[model samples]
Target: MRITPRPPETVAPADIDLFDPERFRSGDQHGAWRTLRETAPVWWHERAGQSGFWCVTRYAECERVLKDYRNFSSEHGTILASVGAPDPAGGATISLMDPPRHTALRTQAMRSFSHTVVRNRTPRVTARVAALVDRLGEGEQDLAELARSLPMAVTGELMGIEEQYWDRLAHWSAVGLTPEDPAFAVGASTAATLSTSHHEIFACFMEIIAHKRANPGDDLISALIALAPGGRPMDDGTLLLNCYSFMAGANSTTPHVINHTVLALAERPDLWRSVAADETLVPALVEEGARWTSTPYHLVRRAVNDVVLAGVPIAAGDWVCAWLPSANRDESVFADPYEFSLRTLPSPHLGFGAGPHYCIGAPLSRMALGVFFRELVRRFDGVDITAPPQHLYSNWINGFSSVPVRARRRPAVASSMPAAREGACAHGTS
Candidate 1:
């Protein structure tokens, strides 16, 4: 199935700039993406003083680029910030490597984030999520702030990080990914902020690595310390880079998924009531939320060999970016792509990505979302959006810096009633 091409007059292609943070912040990127997807699914994006790249917006093309790692190398970089330059951490970090090494490192890391591991940790995760949910006041509260603490708390103890350092790590991860956002700008400039964040996070990991080396525990860091993938032990540089990768991956996307889910529910009262009445639907909601949010909006890969994508000839060493959010909303792949519906089960959306480089932390992120929403529906009757969400100023992460919400506690009677009875009551049919 092919997307119906839109009229050329409808979209001003010259004004579209995929690298501009303001396009995303102003929410104009969605329209631009739609235009691109329909008109030029595989289009060249040029910028003055920088090398141009191909933008893959449709579902099939995006998936093809991600899965075809041989032709499209990640060794150069995985974000536009490093475009036209080699990433120092490229071959060393798990996120920036190709197979064999990538496979070995991911296999070692997968043990800690496996479904069994996440399942075992669920009870504790649920307890923590419940406690956090219980602490919310009745009036307006920043859901973004509440969401930020979750991934750190869940992954921190799993990684043997001290509880006191979770908040700091979360802050640094946010800043590192989206330093251009004023909310995270502590240094003189965006580059300075990014440098400071990277320095602090690496230093923190170094200290943790030293402690783990002395007092090894049943945790990820310790396991990595013991792991000798390919008969070569990991050096501190590799360890620190992977540690930063893990922390950033764990902390960045899940919170935005949570915040976006709540905000979506708040806007759709009927959907909120349905999920609130039936906790079983929470999993479906979680899946749909991940699809809807599509955080980490785009991923960049440099072509290792010349290849033709969607009829467009891409040359060797040319950078290619797959717009994940755009792919998730492709008209041919999703029916009513713009609408948020829980019925989109068995979702083929590239939310966690596709192929060998798929996110290793996916199971952990899914577990956190499931536990959080289950606890949320049990405690809250409904949530209301108090104001517009403050979106993060970055083309990389499709997330909010602030989401003000007012939640109403579930009534005592409603809490005690059965699911069917609660549904009936919610509909005023009793």
Candidate 2:
């Protein structure tokens, strides 16, 4: 989608500048969003120079926005920064397209992520997780380092990226998502860093695409290239955008979920012990973590026509954002919304979102998380959080760049030396 200059619409009430990145940086947005969900389900945020947008904070309203794409259309953009951008990849990309087009494009990519595909790929995921666990040191280490690196390497394998290029891919993805974070910056300024990273990412994909065209493989890149959607080969630009989307979608959110999962478990050794005892609970715990973390906080959409959401009038051509964190924490939907628990299995979490634009990598993400956590339990009895988690500086994404922790490998007291001695004595006597 090309960036287009949009005329300022009628000003929304200045209750809060939801666009203010500082709210997220300070980690105060959750409280603010919770309050809005109760008091004002549909709140408007006006940026000083930029046009204001409506925020749907309630679960019902957010779901309505997601499902009613006819009114709340992604044709404009699905991300805050891309709205009104001339080249939003509206028609070409699955994410930015509406019903008919979106359905078709999504179908093309959906096959690669089907139940069978993910099921067949489980062994690879398990091996990857086990290898990662093997590399963990005995004492204090940054859990976030493993959290950040492991997902990228696994996702890189899925995308057919060379092992050597995994770090570069992670760096580009980090800069792309959190350009505001100085740690991710490539140059002196965030803007320059984002620009350089985006250009490099696109250039790298161009080389990959060229190579894939020459030599087809089992990778997603080759699969997309081989596909003739509507009996015509997809254009190179659209293909490149899809490649970027896959990388961003797969690499950005999962690490945060993993980090948050580790932190949550570390806080409750009882819960950790339970998971270590029964590996079957790992999948449920993974879902709960995704809900609790709300990694992908919100997704943006534009109003196709004037519509009232939860009694709030949204004008045609206005922007609408669905705050996933607020929805995930909706009291009406989730019992004890703020409290995280494995019992909240099969949660209707909006972490992957809802409706047509739901995350395509949901299955893969779940598989990867389950494998990681199960392997974690096998290797470590528990985690000891070493320091406070450092969150990423974006309102769009609820993620942490660093969460320090130590992986403790000792078996529980119940199953340690005494039990081992008894077993040895029994075996010798027998």
Candidate 3:
């Protein structure tokens, strides 16, 4: 599926079923996306059971769709499942709303994951991640599983859930987001499984909400409960949906970025050593990983009115998906788009998306990534992939299903450890 340098003016729509669940099962998706970007920046994708949708492949076109909510609206939904259909959440989720109303809900939720809040929570988050790293012990481990544990810990803390529930919460989050994924497949009926799993998760959230209502605390649930939109506390149903939103936001996506960052940096010892030596570069490394991984490849939007995007006619009521991963790798937007570098990146990536529907969990995500990588570089000199990583067969999430890797702890320097002094100096501390 690799796109040749010179592709045809457009792709054969039949060959590329953008809605196919297996489309992303191999390395082919990347090339397929590249071809779409070059040949049909605004490509049409025909779904088997439903009406066809347009895929906005280039950075400009994707950003245009994301930013211009007037023409391309998210009110229908922001994922492929909701295309040409009403959002199951009934647009109660902030990510599925348009301006004004979206702004209010997003603002309320952002308070819980604001910069100051995340900065304050960093120490606990870091300590939690460090403990997880230590628990990795001295053997080959599935880095993906280890990475998955992190958001559970952090999000668990934010939601005031017991640590024991983290694993189940993570599982539910995965099953909820990608029921079509083989790991969560219970039978031929994925939608039914997802529906049942979501209800269970919702019940858990209701319990948390009920608890928070009676005994409010300094947790995200409390903050959300305290949130009053249009002069009244947000409804219980909205609260439940948003709480689930926060969990899914943190649980499902961040791990992919973490796994990708670890695998990518681990493979490049030179880059790993540079970051290990200087902690300041960790942010850049994290940013690069988000851009490189593009966890949620594309977000769905529906046309509110007829529009011409990149010379293609998109009719009113048409479903469109803005390809974020493709946008991050757009040649015109990024120099040497394929090369992974920690240096200052080109135009900021749309990994967390854009406009009013931008990811509110970004601050928390950064905190998790920052702590995870910093701890990883500080503790392990090398992370070698002992076996090929098993990738998730998901069109939405681009990540490792299992990354088997051996961790090589940094050798302890004897008594007057110059390495310790060098590390301190590099980190600018005593």
Best of the candidates, TM-score:
1
Model 1 Cα lDDT, one tens digit per residue, 1-430: 1111122233588888999898788754667788899899999999899888889999999999899998998888988877877788889888999997789888988898889998887666666666566555447789998888888877987887887788889888888889999988989999899999999898899999999999999889998899898898899988998888888887779999988888777767788889878878888898888888887889899999989998899999889999998898888988877778886468888989998889888888888888788777777777777777888999889888998888888877334524323334443311
Ranking by TM-score: 1, 3, 2
Q: Please list the residue runs of candidate 1 whose C-alpha ends up more than 4 Å from where it truly belongs after superposition.
A: 1-10, 413-430
- Deviation from native of the Cα of residue 247 in model 3, angstroms: 0.7
User: What are the Cα lDDT values of the candidates?
Assistant: 0.83, 0.75, 0.77
Worst 10 residues of 2 by lDDT: 1-10
TM-score of each: 0.92, 0.89, 0.90
Candidate 2 per-residue lDDT, tens place, 27-136, comes to 44665676677678898776677777788888999899999989988877777776556345776777778887778778867777777888877666666665666455
**Order of the predicted models by lDDT, top scorer first:** 1, 3, 2
- The lowest-lDDT stretch of 10 consecutive residues in candidate 1 is 1-10
* Alpha-carbon deviation at 82 in model 1, angstroms: 1.6
Q: In angstroms, how far off is 217's CA in candidate 2?
A: 2.0
Alpha carbon lDDT at 160, candidate 3:
69
